[model samples]
Target: MVNPYGPDTRGTFSFGIRLGLLFEVQAACLSAICVVGLLVYLGWTAIRTRRQRGKHALPSHLHVLFVSLLFSDLLHSIGSILNIPWIRDSGVLEGPLCTAQGIFRQMGDTGVALEILAIAVFTWGVIVRGWSSPSLKTTFVIVGLIWIFVILITLVSYGVHKAAGQVYYGNTRYWCWIRSPYSLPDGIALQYGWFWLTAAINLVLYISVAVTLLKSKRRCRNAQMPEGQRSLQKIAFQMTWYPIIYLITITPMSITRLWIFTNPEHPPPFAATALAAVLLTLSGVFNAVLFSITRPTLIPQKGHDHDPTVGGLRSIYTLEFCQRPDEDQRSSKIPPSPETPCHGEGTSKGGGTDETYV
Candidate 1:
């Protein structure tokens, strides 16, 4: 007698089986918690920023990009939170449910890519131009263009296959994926194409932003900045660190995709999936952490000493002033020395001088 759910056919008892399973469960739980927290934080921040701006407006173009990123992340987190339990109970490599899971996963992937692109572009623009109010019209146009391009590409490739035949429903985990019936070459190509293209774009954007930030930091160090302005610069540098976190968490998954594309015959079973899940979970958690730390004013402060308006205004003024070479040069000029006080009865040349403030 043979059991239907036995290990022999199902490919259980594999390397790192127990550990992988435990990690997957833990990652799912952690991701869910992070998603909940992120949603609350972002929602509150958006509302607060809107109210402060009056007429429900974003504080700046960069702020708009940040909001878009948070919104996309929230969507991805929600999808993952739902999909994880279903994957656990039903198994990702089996049954009709896999198709649904694949679709959701693909959507989440798209959201992540869009968010990263937005962050990279926005940060680059801010660092390069010192834009205080990024044109909303321009931002919306860029977002529209990206969405349209992605949709067109997806439709032209995967849409045709799914429409022409029953490409989705199968034991295959290729629901949101494009695959061939007889040969694996086409499927492999499509998979690698998507992963590599996204990776290349992300690498370029992040590297550019990182380089610009380093240059900015160097320039700032050479210039004399006020305490408040220096604090703002530090916050901006800290924000730049999120891209490194993005690269670390997403690079492994990209490499795994490349491996699978090159050698599809013997794809690692639970290990690869579990690893990808862990990376994605970490990405979501880190993003939430970054948002919290970099934008503390977005959080509701009860009896807090920090004034969000003054801080924001000072940051804006500093950024604007720093952009002007003439202003910077003029600011560096030395002030006239204070006039010497006349000596009194007990005053000597060194000891009797009046205390003077610049």
Candidate 2:
């Protein structure tokens, strides 16, 4: 009798053998649980928001990018969760199901990376560059472009591989993906490159935003920074954690994949591969937890939307730092009123006015 699975045990099938398969199974199961919890939370929130329709309308315009990110995470988690079936069977092989997993994995990963990048860029523009929130048409256009790009790349790769009589997606030791032989081109082009790109851009944008806020704070320090400025600064710092968490979740798996790519002759240790799978699968959970931490108030209180402290992450979208230099002189002439509390009031000691971003 033959082992049937490849001898890549050391040089192949790192997780293919029964001894190491448990790790992948466990990782997928864990991801499923978290994904379900996230779904429940979203559903519950939707129900509550609907019930309070008169008091609170869904801030779909504000959270367009956010909702897209959550959808991507869902697809990615489902791809990982697919591994549960393989685990129960004790083996994986190339087939339609395998192909489906690979496609979902690639699409979801690419979508998530792109969505994160979009959010980071949008946030920086609004907060640091002083740009207004994007119009709904522009938002949908951007989101559509991202999905189109992801689909085109994945399908193109699949077509090319199929036409060449190759497996576009085949079994790795643990899960199905671009397969070992084509991992270099397909992996980098379809999946990992997006992750790396998002990581780099997000790190830079959030850092720049944080630094800008800090500088603004220092300028207002003597005058005593207004609560609005202070809140902006705090949120800026908190936003940095988004990229950090993203990096942490993807790093272990990235390292393993790169290691395998460069040194095909020497497969990583079983423990390394297993650990990487576990970490990578938990990305959805990591993202969910990070969002919860960064954006605590998903639904604003009935009448507290204007309250910066209670606004949560929504404040970043709705609050402006200081008025633009052009608006300052004119805005100051108008007296503050109930409808515009932060308009002309909240002046700093330096004769500059601090207004909540309207």
Candidate 3:
């Protein structure tokens, strides 16, 4: 009589398997907890302040983007949390349930790409093209477009999964994403394929913003322009590090997975796979830190509708860095610091550095 759950554990050590599985579970669980807390707080604040902004108000930069991003993170973290039990126990989940998990995982992965791409595009618009704040309706429209994009792509993948059958979670990947996550008949076309394209678009936009900012900064210094009127690129740079950080953190997983795809005969070291799992799982945590979800809102009275009397700068190019003595009575956060390059950026998530790996 053959055992139905067939115990063919060749080339897989029991202790090593247990340890690796435990680590993956812990990373995903912990990351989920930390990131979800941030998401909750952000969502609550957005809801509470909705009416306070007055009617027909347009909030400062990318209000919809932050909220949409938190939703995606929530989906990501929750999917991981639910999968812990499934991954640890021996058995298959209900068909529709597994299908739901696959969709949620795709939502998070694809959703992130759209979010970062939106931010990068936003940065380019403000810096290069002199675009200003988008109205509330316009912002919601953008949010709708992103969500729709993710859903359509996810359905495409789900269609493929139903046709293929076996392997929904934890075949090649440790977490609860589509199995053989970065490979294919279907994986590349659905999952990992988006990785490189998103990364490339982000890099180009970041470079453009960085160069434009530096040039503007130097010109301001030479001409002795009023300090208050300098471009806010340095500070803006802080908020723009997400795409860069995302790329840096995901590179390890990408490289290792590619190697496995190319050299299937010789399995890569368990350690390599473990490192990748660790980084990928901690992604939401990094996003929370980068966005400063725990800190005070950077733009005050932001939720209230736009007041024409508000003296905020017209575009990022003309944004003021130094506060004038007259405006000191106001509750502005940006401070004066002429000598240091990246100084005055509060340790808030807006600082142009990433703590994701750390």
Better of 1 and 2 by TM-score: 2
Tell me the tens digit of each residue's lDDT in model 1 across 257-343: 556556665655656766875786566667767766776465556775234332332243223212222343454333311221001
Better of 2 and 3 by lDDT: 2
- Writing each residue's lDDT as its tens digit, candidate 2 over 45-93 gives 6566556443433443335666677677777777876766566666576
The candidate maximizing TM-score is 2
Error of 3 at 148 (Å): 1.7
- Candidate 1: TM-score? 0.68
TM-score (C-alpha, index-matched) for candidate 2? 0.77
Colliding residue pairs in candidate 3 = 53-304, 53-305, 57-305
Give the range where candidate 2 is weakest over 10 consecutive residues by summed lDDT.
349-358
lDDT of each: 0.49, 0.66, 0.57
- Best of the candidates, lDDT: 2
The reply for model 2, stretches above 4 Å from the true place, is 1-21, 43-47, 50-62, 224-232, 299-314, 317-358
Error of 3 at 147 (Å): 1.7
For candidate 1, the lDDT comes to 0.49
Error of 1 at 106 (Å): 1.1
Q: Estimated TM-score per prediction?
A: 0.68, 0.77, 0.71
